[model samples]
Target: MEEKYFEISTENLKKFIDGIITDNYEVIAPTDKDGDTFYGKINKFEETNLDILLPKMSYKEYLLPKTETLFEYSISGVDTEVKDGLQNIAGANEKRVIFGGRPCDAGAGPIMEKVFNWDYKDEFFNERFKNLTIISIACEKPDNYCFCTEMQLSPESSYGSDILLKKSGDKYFAIVTGEKGLNLVKAYSNLFTETAKDKVPADKDWKKIFEVEKTKSFLDKNFEHNYFQERFLSCIGCGVCTYTCPTCHCFDIQDEGNLKEGRRIRNWDSCQFGIFTLHTSGHNPRVTQGDRYRQRLMHKFKIYSEKFDKYLCVGCGRCSRNCPEDIDIKEVAKNLAEMA
Candidate 1:
């Protein structure tokens, strides 16, 4: 497909965003909340905050909520009935824009879509994904833990982004990638002007080198390797990495309420906990922190990729940033690659 480029100054960008608000579409962007940045709902032009680094959490929560009700059931004596639990959001059917998303955050949605659509389709997730438009802001100042380049993705990667915006002087160089993006551009054509693509300097420093293939190969042959036991000695099993990850999608189904009335809920779960794999017989296969940690790495680099032709991780670095023990994934991958 031919790439289309447009230029929009700061003023025009604000106008375009305001137009979205006027049209009754929700705009979610990075915002400062309690001195930390997070993807939040924006009502005005001034609400969007892009000066900070990446948000603490990825935008996954917007699509697959942290907690969702699957269905509701009620019973009185001998009568029992089940009912749908989905409640429509206000203007949910309208297009929602994820403005100013980073490349890694924007790219993770499509990677996760694979599993949700596999075997059985998750209707709840699909509905939100179908109605959403992703607008990515290319990274200019990646931090120390960022290793997207090592995972074969760059700041400019546009795998799941409908539109990509790169800052060029006082204006932005924008590229519309899909039908939704094209429609948005055409609707706001007056705000955009044709321009050349911005030139990225070669001296821009990113993170460490990685051998993704080597890491996968090592895991394939060393399924019983001692490094899994030795490397996770300091792990506290807090599950912070999995919770903050852009790609981890494990969940637990729970029934809430009394015996007379109840709602089945799907809440996010993590493999880091022993109860995550505990059976009714009280036998837990992944009993140790090392075993759980190994499963995390295996699913991310080896198993998921082998099944879906894509790595489960997007190299966003959120896991390393939020890990209490400072266990960096890039460091683990580098050590595995160099191992005998």
Candidate 2:
């Protein structure tokens, strides 16, 4: 693919982000809040905290919100008026720049796009994506939890990112791609300096890349296997895994208000919940916690891949890291790989 590379000093990185904010663009970056880093809207460049690891939440919320109004209705006398609840958070009206995002988080955008655009196209997600520019920072020091390599992804993978930045010495090498990325480079031309053609920084911390193909092969034959129950017995049926995941996009729609008027709202939902697949007759297809957990694994590793030709997981390892039961996805994948 055609790409343009430019180098910018570490000191000038703040100025580059500040310039985007000054131009009336919403700058969303990793911001420190209560000792935890989260992707939040930043008014100034100083508000961003890039030193932390991956944020507790993914950038999916920016694209598909946790809670959004679908439409609003009002009634006066015998007349009723219905209005569309349009979303303005990072849409055509206000442009967005996601800076200092991890590559795995950046990669989630494309995977989620496939699901959103499947049979029924979602206009809200489509419009906001067009107006957003992703500026992802390559991980310099990945911990044991990082397993992007297993998913055929890495700190350097620029799958869904517009611009990928990697730290090299005292400067950051920016690899520009897509129309929005090139436009940013042209606008802030002074901040970037032309670098050597062959200069590319290496991610030293990422050493072990798991055998994903082997794991997929095992999962292909183990759908009805009894191992799933034992594997997920310790799971507490919490929705933390789906909530922190970047590609989990299940949602529930509910209408709120009295008989006079009401508003339909869409909120994030998870497959781990017992009521997620419950029918109106009080019959739940996934009855036990193990059943829910098995569905989660199958959806991520088998079902989604069979339908979309891509795995639902990006291997960011947040699920494994935050799991109270210490159910490491990487270990599970490795066990499956050994079975094959």
Candidate 3:
């Protein structure tokens, strides 16, 4: 279907969201919590905090949970029985609407989706991704940490969003980019005006800080470069960077329970951890923090791109903004570009 444009007043937009909630769709939006903004479930439109550029964490958790059960097994004497864990997930089939995320946050869904569907289909992630609708608002005032433009994504880009909303005075110029968005507009026809808003408001002037191609080239040639070792000296290997990153998808599987019964679960894991590559024989491949950090950069800039043809990063700046050591990824990329 061809893309369509419509203008919706702020009043009507609120009503539309409220209508979605009334229709039994779970609405997730940025909400204030302890003076920090985080994505959480909202019952009404009034709970959404759209003023923030981005949330502390992306809405990825809603799709790929921090910890998910994969399967369950029980042992009876010498016989064993296994059961699928999909039925154990609460709200696995619920329809969800992710509203007011930034373009970077929305762009991360597709990037992660590629990995989930790479070799083996991840039914756990696919179930949530299929039921979710992303409605991202374009950024008008980005701060120093934002670098979405460097990753080939602009504030107004609708790459992963079903609907992209740009603020224009008291109304929003909405661009429906896919079938989901078209169906949404059709359902809420009373809220959206027929009068088309042809022109979307201009995006903020977010300058490209570094050339990603040059950074990729640098990584491709210099895997053993001392830059990675010397630069991340302050990195305490706390795994906070991976936790806050929108595109980090590494995980570890563990079995829990006694001999009678147990469940296999997938838990979020980080390469930044020291024990991540620790073998059972006690010889770890990535011995130092620098080695672990280099793996992270290589995976994001070089390895994943070579396989998927898309960088495993959206330049949301959450990893840098939330870093206790204040180590910035944008700066690292810029430095690599200059070296190249």
> Candidate 2's residue-wise lDDT over 103-160, tens digit each?
9999999999999999999987887777779999998777777888778688788889
What's the TM for model 3? 0.95
Ranking by lDDT: 3, 1, 2
Question: TM-score: which is higher, 1 or 2?
Answer: 2
Q: Give the better candidate number (1 or 3) by TM-score.
A: 3
Question: Where in model 2 is the C-alpha error above 4 Å?
Answer: 87-93, 202-209
Looking at model 2, residue 114 earns an lDDT score of 93
lDDT of candidate 1 over 1-101, digit per residue (tens): 56677888988999999998899878999988998989999998799898866889988998888998888889989999987755554347467999988
**In model 2, how large is the Cα lDDT of residue 240?**
92
Instruction: Please report the TM-score between candidate 2 and the true structure.
Output: 0.95
lDDT tens readout by residue for model 3, 284-309? 99988889989998998889999999
Off by over 4 Å in 1: 75-81, 87-93, 196-208
Query: Where is model 2 poorest over a 10-residue stretch in terms of lDDT?
Result: 86-95
Q: After superposition, how far is residue 148 of candidate 2 from its true place, in Å?
A: 0.7
Return model 3's CA RMSD, one decimal: 1.8
Overall lDDT per candidate, in order of appearance? 0.86, 0.85, 0.89
Ranking by TM-score: 3, 2, 1
How big is the positional error of residue 84 in model 1, measured in Å on the Cα after superposition? 1.6
lDDT of 2 at 78: 92
In terms of lDDT, the best-performing candidate is: 3
